[model samples]
Target: MPIKTTKKVTNKKVVKEETKPAVEAKKEEVKTAEVKKATKPAVEIKKEEVKPAETKKAPAKKATTKKAAKPAVEAKKEEVKPAEVKKAPAKKATTKKAAKPAVEAKKEEVKPAEKKKATAKKTTKKATTKTTTTKKVTTKKMTKEEQYAKLSLDTCLDLAKAMSMNVTRDSIIQQLILNPDVKSVSKDLVNKYQLTGKFNFEEDGYDEGLVEVLVSKVYETADIKPQKAEDLQADVDHALNYKFTDVVADGEEYKAQFDTMRKVLMIAQHKDIHDSKNLDEEIGIDVEKFVEEFMDLAYSVLKTWKYEDVDYYEHFIYAVLSQLEDLHDTYRNRIMMDVADLYILHGDYGLGDADYGYILRENQIKDYIYYRYASIYEGVDKDKAKQIANQALQFVDDRFTYYPNIIAVLEG
Candidate 1:
């Protein structure tokens, strides 16, 4: 019985050993399954943390997109401002173009008014020029009296037709008689009327009106007694019949004395006194005596006529001196020098005196008179002498050849 129990114990031990290994393997498997469950929970925690980080990243991306969109909007607004600026310039350009046409139209409207003003001014200027031209033309014409005044004394005498049978009641003759330049014409007419009785109304059938006018003019110009027109014919007849005795009581005697004086002058002319050095010895006639007598005769004639018959005295002196014109210059000059010397010595006579008019009518006598006066004034007033000497040279005649010598003496 003991042997059989040993065998059973051995079998039981073997089976226990096998069953212990199996239980260990089963324990390890259970440990592994629990660890796996714990690891799965950790992995799940990490996944949650990762998911939070992804959400923060997503919000950062959205903020960046919004910032980018704001910049785009600002860029679009800036572009719109530039477009509006370009439209403003275009509007200004259109306005300026429209204003230019308006200004041009205003200029066109003013042009015609300016042209009308210019035309009116031109027409007024032309009208003023025409008026001035007409005034100038009117002022150019002279009158008849002015024309006659310009004529010479000889021309006036010729126009009068004096001392001719064709002489009529001419207004020109009356004008000439009244003209102071031809005052001697009155004396000539009177002498002719007295000599030829040409003015006798009934005898010569002369115009009574003309005779009366002639008588009136002669007496009036001589400053003599003015006779009536009715008595002119009787006075003229009486003058003719009595040899001008009605005018002067000693008319014939005065005439004879003039004739004698003329003969003496003729004798002096024939002697050629210019060539004679000793005038007193060569020509028996005394020049000083002759000049004195001639002056005395002139004074006597003037005194007899109450100094009112200047024309008669002038005529007588002219008649006497006219004969000496043909004489040599030397003799004539010597005679005139003597006369000037005598005049200066007298001291009462001036060159302006009417009595000296006939003497001065001869150019040589005038020059000598000036020379004498200048020479006399040279000692007292040198300036006055030079002035007088210079005046002598102003005469336009051939007799003033010695004037330069006188001037040289004055200058010296």
Candidate 2:
């Protein structure tokens, strides 16, 4: 019995020991469960904090993007403003180019106007030149014979005077003969030498003989036969022997008759005295007798003559004076004094008649007379010569151009 008891007790001890170990293990497990619950709550709180921080960071990033977009927009507006300014300058350049074309067009218009004016001037010059050339051509087309034929006897005389040629009857006849028309020549001859009475062919005077000779020569030159020649001869003879009656004494017809006689005498005497080799033989009279007779005849004619043509009488006196100078005879001073007296008387008459040319001719003659007197008295009477020379100086001027000897004496 005792041995059974000891084995059961040992089994009970072993069981108790095993049960204690199991209880301690259960206590430790419960403590570990409680710590795990506390740790789970702390992890949940940390997750909530992380979620709020992430929301704030998202708002900051969106603000930065908005600022960047504002700067880009301002830069784009600045670029657009520069482009607009450049376009305005380009528009101004275009307007300037257009104005240049307008100026050039105006200049072209002015050039055309100037061209028209120049053309007008040129046309006027050409017209004037053409007119002058036509006039010259017409004048050149006329012949000398045609020109002379167109002239009248008066015009011919004027031409002779203008040409400084001698206006003599022979020169006039020569000029008249140049006319081709025979009727004109016949008419001229008839007008110049027509007679009104019978002429004495056997007249004793040299002038009558010379007139007869001149008529004969004219008839011979004309060679007009029968009727015309007879008429001309009869007319000339009548004119030569025309009688001066009291009824026609103051008439133009009587004056013409006296003029014809004087002309015949002067022409014949001058020709015979200047051209004849033997003046006495040609005139059938001594030189002294001829001069005396001519002077008497001229003085008689001058006393009766009351015409404007005093130059005709002057010619007659000058012819006789020239002959006297050639003779150098004792009658020279007397004849010169007579001529001077005649000139003085005529000069006084010319003052009343208002003939300036006659007064000038008288002054010339007086100067000549004084010079001649001075020369003649120079060797004979010194005081008288000096007095005459000083008197001549009063008339000395450009009109004394033909009297160089007179000027020399006056100066000396």
Candidate 3:
């Protein structure tokens, strides 16, 4: 009974705590309820609340809730309804606050997964790019090798032919055949080895293996007999001594002399006059020396026939003069006078013009050389010839014969 009394006291205290605002709300609702008993919905809600409260507030000793306790219970229930309405918005606010974190947590969870997926995509892209680069590098190397392999034998032959234009036709083929990988030889292969020279093919017939055999032959016959200065000098002497008995023979002889002179000129043009050969006994006589020696010999031998064989004299003088240099004054004067005489005979006035320095420095037989040159120029430029003749007159001595005819031509 005591415990039951204590529980009722606690319940009453709970009701009393809500009573202040509830009583105010109930007074407001009662005024409104009387005015709108049939029309207002809040009046019906208040009556429903009152009925439940009356049943709950029955005395503790009664088997059933006592009817005498009804009015107070109804008033208490109306006051409690206002408290429950106030608490309803608070419960909804608590539930909304709890639900907000769950939504945020879902977004946070999805963000990491999306980031991982983006990262995976980037990694795959990088991997694909690397694969493509590696494939391109491999393919490029393969293509270059294949390009070299695909080069045709015809192209090789063409390269050999083109290079042969400068060297020999068979020389290129010979080099290709000598190579261990002859079948693989191409234009670039020949270029890599840098093979060149004249071709001397001795065989009569043509065969596919002919080029290869020639190439092999070059290596076997690579020995060259070093030419001595004496041998070259002998050849020149033979060429200069060539003589003619008649007009037909004279043309042929002159042509031979000119051709021989041309060869000597070609040899003189080489930078290494002696080449690689060591011909120690032959001193001070290279291609140039050989040429000078030949000229002196020709002049001594040919001077007797100069007036009768005008064509031969002209040819011989022009050949010697073509390779002659005006280095030693005595030697130069002899060559110049000989060339000047040839010019007079040939009517080539331009060839007779000598350098003034070369003329002034001539010491041996100076008067004779000056007079002779002056005589040649008299037909072209008489005033200039007279001046030269006057200069020659100063050098005349008892040792020399000053020709009166030279003076007469120069004066005219």
At residue 162, what lDDT does model 3 achieve? 46
lDDT by residue (tens digit), candidate 1, 1-412? 8964553443232222121222243454435333222222233223323443353343222112223222212222222233333323222322232222222322332344455557667979999999999999997676544444454544444444544523443432332323322335545554554534444434543332343344334334443222232433343233233333343645554555544444444343445343223333544434444444545444434433433244334444444444444333434544444444344334424632333345556655466566666675565557867876777777624556566666764585
Which ranges in model 3 have alpha carbons more than 4 Å from their true place?
Answer: 1-237, 244-251, 261-330, 340-351, 354-357, 361-365, 378-387, 397-412
Model 2 root mean square deviation, Cα atoms: 44.6
Tens-place lDDT digits, model 2, residues 1-412: 8954553443232222121222342454435333222222333323323453353343222112223322212222222233333333322332232222222322333344455567667978999999999999988666544544455555544543443334444533332233323445444443445421223323421211232233333434542222222223333345444444544443444445443333333434435444322543443334444445445444445534554334444544454445445544444545445444444345443332233234344553565556655664455556655765776667765576436666666556
Per-prediction TM-score, please?
Answer: 0.22, 0.26, 0.30
Tens digit of lDDT per residue, candidate 3, span 1-412?
8965554543353222222232343354435333222232333334434444454574423211223223323333322433333433222322232222222322333344455567667979999999999999887655333443444444434434544423343444333322322333333333444532233222321223333333333334443223344545666566545554655555555545544554443343332233312221332234445445445544444433444354444444443343343323235566666655655545555555644336557566565666677876666667878887777767765466765655665567
lDDT of each: 0.42, 0.41, 0.44
Best candidate according to lDDT: 3
Clashes of each: 0, 4, 1
For candidate 2, give the lDDT of residue 233.
Answer: 32
TM-score winner between 2 and 3, please give it: 3
Model 2 clash pairs are 195-235, 195-239, 196-239, 197-238
